[model samples]
Target: MVKIGIADTTFARFDMGKAAIDELKRNCSAQIVRYTVPGIKDLPVACKKLFDEQHCDIVMALGMPGSKPVDKTCAHEASMGIIICQLMTGRHIIEVFVHEDEAPDARELAALMEKRAREHALNVVKLMFKPKILEKEAGTGQRQGYEDVGPARI
Candidate 1:
């Protein structure tokens, strides 16, 4: 049996962790270990605990960085921590982040977070158990609903 760990922050309006869990449950049976923290900065430790204590197979670390410049900096730092944790543990940690300032309005932000969470949940399932489901788009560079912002080669 696969154990999925979910680390979520309480700073967001939408319930991204729940959305991810719901999406995951639709595909197959698995035990979901959930840990909620106060903000993005707390995500790394929470995820570490979930892996070391709960024995999760894969982890989804979800956060919503605010609109301030300092918030982005915090997000970057938190991301680095997560990367370090993944390297140390030799496990996959899906970073599910939706910056609060990405959308212009509240409704759009909520919708995007929900959709993104669910999509990433499926990705978690694929990465852990069914790799074939994800292989169909191996090199398509298709990010679902997100617009492509490929690098420039000028």
Candidate 2:
């Protein structure tokens, strides 16, 4: 059985991890492992632990960055760390970051988080079980939380 890992932050106002897990459960038969930390900066290590200790085949690093410059900086740094962790482990980490500024209100922000997390969860399923589906979606300009921009007209 496939094992999917989820690393999330309490700094987030919403529970994006739950959304991802729900989606995963609806679509696949994978063993889901979750690790929660206090802030976005801690997601990388949490993901690493899930991979190393729990032996997850893939991971989703979910975070919600506040609408501030400092928060943006921290989010970027966390993203880089996640990349490095992926490189070190030779596995895929789907970084799902929803900035608080992306939406005008808390309700919208929460909705966005759920949409993005669920969509990425589907991507995880495709990656693990049906990668050919992803190949078919290449260059389609897919968007998770909002309307897709569609492929560019050259």
Candidate 3:
């Protein structure tokens, strides 16, 4: 399985990211791990933990643009954040920005992120993990496979 790590910087408690990951799980078999950071500045340590400990094959950041529009797009900001992650940890990264209002918008962003990952020569799978409020399945574990990968051997 492709080890994938997803980080969400948005204020929401990874709701959007969870949606996106669910969609990906249906189509692709990737080891998706989701994270939510308090803010943008706290991303480095978070990325370090994801990259170093998780041993993620791909690291993708999720940015959600709410109703009140921001000047810069989430994709743009995520790209910059990916750079910081790359520099800090010497690992290839991919970032996807999901426009939550419309489902099509999220799909469009996912495609773009995938293309960007390809351009960067990284075996990365990037997409928007949108969140949904569906009823949970009975007997299914709530927190499945969200464990840490331990330290990387030098």
Residue-wise lDDT of candidate 3 within 1-113, one digit each (tens)?
Answer: 66777676765323445655655565567687777786444455566678888887666565545434552454456567668778877775555443444344655545543
Tens-digit lDDT track of model 1 for 1-154: 9999999989977899999999999976999999999998999898899999999989999989999999999999999999999998999999999999888999999998998898889888889888987787565554633764454555
- Better candidate number, 1 or 3, judged by lDDT: 1
Model 3 has a clash total of: 6
- Give the alpha-carbon lDDT of every model: 0.89, 0.96, 0.52
Best by TM-score: 2
- Which window of 10 residues has the lowest lDDT sum in candidate 1? 144-153
TM-score of 2: 0.98
Using TM-score as the measure, name the better of candidate 1 and candidate 2: 2
Q: Candidate 1 vs candidate 2: which has greater lDDT? A: 2
List candidate 3 segments past 4 Å from native. Answer: 10-14, 65-81, 88-90, 98-154
Against the hidden reference, what TM-scores do the models get?
A: 0.92, 0.98, 0.50
